[model samples]
Target: MTEQISVLEKKIEEVTKRISDLKDIDSIRNLHHTYGYYFDACLFNEVVDLYAEDSEVRFMGGIFKGKESVRRFFCDRLRMRHSNGHNGPIYGFLLDHIMMQDVITISEDGKTARGRYRTFMQAGRHELAEGLTRQWWEGGVYENTYVNEDGLWKFKILDYRGLWHADFNTGWAHTPPNLYPFFSDTYPNDPIGPDEILDIVPKPVLWPDTGVLPFHYPHPVTGDEWDQNKDLNTSK
Candidate 1:
């Protein structure tokens, strides 16, 4: 009878741990998805609040280190450019970032987690806007890390690799190279630039050049890294 009770207790403990891990995964997913909604509405300050104080951002070959620097990139730079320094969506601008396909992995201790998500973005200025009226389709990948702050999870590292972009009318097949230029200048000097410029090898390209953004995790079943040379091609 005592042996049976011990077995049952062990089984209960195992179940509890599994439940905890699943909760962590869900929390992390919700955190990221919330960020997407905030970003889509151009809530720059709110987006920055989702990050840890020591968090960093890697975007378009530029490394914006620390929460303050990330603030400069998103709040100061992006807000001015997109919404004319407004906190919410503007009348003539449309920037919708749809984040999905999250593969989240929680640490054994549950203090940290890693996730990979894909973002499909549609951004442009409407004819009512004061700027050039153009619409575009953009796809990117986010290989990010999260840290559990007390009980809440926050972004520790946000590394977004914009793979390809195309004009709404032209599409990917007719897209030109370097549609969106990477940061060539650093911060302080450029006012709204990144803290550091990463020298990426095999430099990332745009459509019609199909460059595969490397995956953060290995294959779940096979446990093998993706082949970078597998079927990717460049435009003529």
Candidate 2:
């Protein structure tokens, strides 16, 4: 009877864990989608609220650490375009941030999670003086970490690995990103550190022609989980 009771308890624990994971997965999905809509509408404050206090955001090669910096990235650099009135839409926000192919995995402890998704964005820009109106398409991937705190999910790290940006008229085939990289009329705070892989401009190599942002997690098929104790050569 004792042995059978122990087995029953184990089964119950497993079931409970599955239930928690399912709930967490749904919550996380909703959370990220909420972030997208908020950002698209230029509701920068709401967007910032989606992150934890110590959250970090890495977008377009700039790594912004902490909530205040993240706020600046959205509210200052992006939303207001550093108050220079050159880039982005002049009247209203013209961000069409579409996310797709999302894969989320909650950890066994149920306290943290990881997600991977791809984004294809449509952006609008207007130069007030030049009367220059333009539209562009951009593509990138996001590998993010999240944590469950106070019964809510918040972004711990949002790393957006930008792939390319192309003019709507010329399209991606005609234009490579580095050749015509974005020239900001206004500058924002410096990044914590930019990823060095794409540092070289006018290079012999380019994205897709090069490779993708490496998975921060591990091989799903091989189950070679990431290990802090191991180096790149040692797949734990």
The prediction achieving the highest TM-score against the true structure is 1
TM-score of 2: 0.77
lDDT of 2: 0.71
> How many clashes show up per model?
0, 0
- Over the stretch 31-143, how does candidate 1's per-residue lDDT look in tens digits? 99999999999999999999999999998888999999999989999999999999989899999989989999888888999999999999999988977889999999999
Each model's Cα RMSD: 2.1, 6.4
Alpha-carbon TM-score of each model against the true structure: 0.91, 0.77
Model 1 weakest 10-residue run by lDDT: 201-210
In angstroms, how far off is 198's CA in candidate 1? 2.2
Query: Tens digits of per-residue lDDT for model 2 on 1-236?
Result: 99999999999999999999999999998999999887777677788889999888766545567888777677766655422433323463367879989888899889999998899999875554333467788888888999999999999999876677778898888775355333222233234233222332332223434335655667878978654333323111
Residue pairs clashing, model 2? none
Model 2 per-residue lDDT at 36: 88
